[model samples]
Target: MSRDTIRADLCIIGAGAAGLVTSAGAAMLNRKVVLFEAREMGGDCLNFGCVPSKAILSAAHAAHTVRAAAKLGVNAGEPKIDFAAVMDHVRKAIADIEPNDSQDRFEGLGVRVIREWAHFTAPDTVESDSVTVKAKRFVIASGTRARIPSIPGLDTLPYLTNETIWQLDALPRHLFILGAGPIGCELGQAFARLGSDVTLVEAGTALGAFEPDHVAVLREALAADGVRLIEGTGVERFSGEAGAITAHLAGGETINASHVLVAAGREPVTDTLGLEAAGIEADARGIVCDDRLRTANRRVYAAGDIAGKGALTHLAGWHGSVILRNLYFGVPTRQSSNPIPACVYTSPGLAQIGLTEAKAREQYGGKVSVTSWPFHDNDRAIAEGDTAGGVKLVLGKGGKLLGVHVAGARSDDIAALAAITMAKGGTVRDLTGPVLAYPTRGEAIKRAAGKHFEPVVFGPFAKAWAGLLSALH
Candidate 1:
């Protein structure tokens, strides 16, 4: 029997942020596009990852604020968390954003949407159970899933992953998390604020990617939220049934909890892609793609977590745009050419773009200049009574912006300005003298930048010049 075949200009696998953008762009350009999605429309970000996580985080933040309102002279009593209602908010967030990524929207945009898993049948073709697609170009944006570690006895005890945690009908009595990455930290704090006893165990330092000082602020915030963080150690094994589980630590101590959440990490979704059939190379990391996102099969490209470049949703979207520019507009663009910004969303959120203080010193040696402005010095933070950490600007030779790290409230919004400056290859001067509004969180960035120019602006030469002018006058 012959399979039904459809030919197109571009064929995309995955309906996540990366694939959706690529399909929309191509379809709107009057190009024939075929998109295959094995699951939901928005993939992990909308359904299981960013969207749901942030929604829960928002709820947790609200509860935390009410509890902390005594500092502002408002005695808002203890918050009573409705775990089911919180989960409802998470579901509602996904539902609201589902329409934009739905099959009807893409189909209306002239894309042939196939609701099935597709894999390479040949170098130029992909075949699913119901149909086959032949295309000029292809994209693999299937994204990723939670990586479950192989701890002894863990298999027998039921555990939760980011994908499965949302299914819980009630709050956990004691939540045991197996990782201390962003997901673990975020959820750990959220659950703790929601009155769940949360413990996070990590073999390495938690949020070690950020500066130690900034990490200290986050540690305090998480501790304040009643999250128990165990770093430099890990679970040796797990035991017990679904309702009651025990985590055996490396040093022999054990932790008993009502639930287990494995936020260890993410594994790229590349199962049964038949990459070898299409001459596309891939490994445990993800599909092997070049700086331009071109796979071993030059006709193919990758985006999102599957690209192995970055796992961020924003990075995924940027990858799609990069591919569109190269394939459609004939423009040369490299994914690495742009700067990436990352944020850990706690009370005093941590946002970083480019190198850290230690990294800058290691890379540039004697050329590194560090400038900082404490949040306590900022009028806004002082007024809010929540000055946790500050903004640190790492500068290289000629005052170039090597990095910008903000560890305070609204750090993401503040770091956004720094992200643009880094993307434009601008120096610290770009962040300086911006006429930023008085007492705003963003002013911290400007103040940090201004610190770099203080010596030059108030130098001996300037003082001499001023003296001469005064004498002449």
Candidate 2:
């Protein structure tokens, strides 16, 4: 090792969501924090993931709205999408949000930001090319990268991953995507609406982690948007070049596409971190951490995608808070106890919190109750002419909220309300009491909650009582 060395109370590796949060929080607590990044400062979320994808989705939604306006009595002309300008918008979003996660920002916050690759050389020490860092604790926030599956001939063809998809100079003629998870579904619908013939191929059920009914609604929405969704199939092989690519499916179907975008999955970036030297246990998934986010070595902790909790940006930030609580304030907190919310930003959107209906059924069996309300019943949804999906709430005995699954316009916003309710140990009854404004999508929540009491509200006894009251009146 070189003579150059740095010392800090906290040393964070990888400058993504988790690393950035931990660095900023620790430094603010008046602790000496050193942050390291081998790639972009903002990592996957800011650079290649959420920000860019959402920007493209926004543009796609605008195009879709113009075409959909006919039903609303608006005669908007056909959208002329400038592909190059769309890419520029994506880049501008990244640029606008870049400075908040830049090296100068952290440096200004009194953090020593190191722009280099770091690896564990000892239990308490990490080394890079120019400097060695000895810290009281280490946090491995090295996020994930796009996972390329081992399809035959895949390596020989040019394909798009999240990292490189935003760089397209021209719109694809026919876009073929693999996987029907959030990434694949979101981008597939976006490109399809933007005038590309899109085919989304998924090996398992689409949105496998969500409820079947919710997935069905999104499937219909995507189909209506001109995306050819091929589920229960995997890519067996790839051939041809960038302009004229082909995918052979496991079921023997062949797809001819102008471009291939692999949204299959993501793998943790832990291979180069030299974890064995630090006695930190990590596998193909990510670092093996306890509920407190501590690795096998007590002095080392992990967060974000490398934590193996979930590859979500918000969860990564939550992990950072857990680290800060446990390390800085001596507060014991478990990462699993917190409610995790996820969303797929399609036109109708799909969002979920806590357990899915399938998981609730599997665990509680007869003890769970599922209530639902359709978007068509909502005034705003009908008025907006976007009534395609609905909301489902999974409750345990006594109406205790076990989960919330929403698929429709503003589903993410509705799921956020459910998250707060669940976080406070509230129940379906709790949601029913709130008098939300009329003619809004939010009223769907109260309507969904009212279903849990429908038996009491509409039973024979209630009808008899209503007859008595009518006679008295």
Task: List the global CA lDDT of all models.
Answer: 0.92, 0.92
> Model 2 over residues 1-473: C-alpha lDDT tens digits?
56488889999999999999999999999999999898899999999999999999999999999998888789998999998999999999999999999999999999999899999999999999999999999999999989999999889888999998888889999999988889999999999989999999989888899878878888888999999999888888999987989999987889999999989999999988999999999878899999899999999999999999999999999999999999989989999878899999997888999888779989999999889999999999988888988999999999989999898999999888889988888999999988888788988989999988989999999999999999999
Model 1 RMSD, rounded to 1 decimal: 1.0
Residue 252 CA displacement from its true place in model 1, Å: 1.3
Candidate 1 per-residue lDDT, tens place, 1-473, comes to: 57799999999999999999999999999999999998999999999889999999999999989999999999999998999999999999999999999999999999999999999989999999999999999999999899988889988987999989999999999999988888999899989999999999989999888888998999998888889999999888888998899999999999999999999888988886888889998878899999999998988999988999878989999998999999999999999989999998887899999999999989999999899999999999999999999999999998888889999899999999999888889999988857888879899999888887888788998888989999999
The list of candidate 2 runs beyond 4 A from truth reads 457-473
Whole-model lDDT, model 1: 0.92
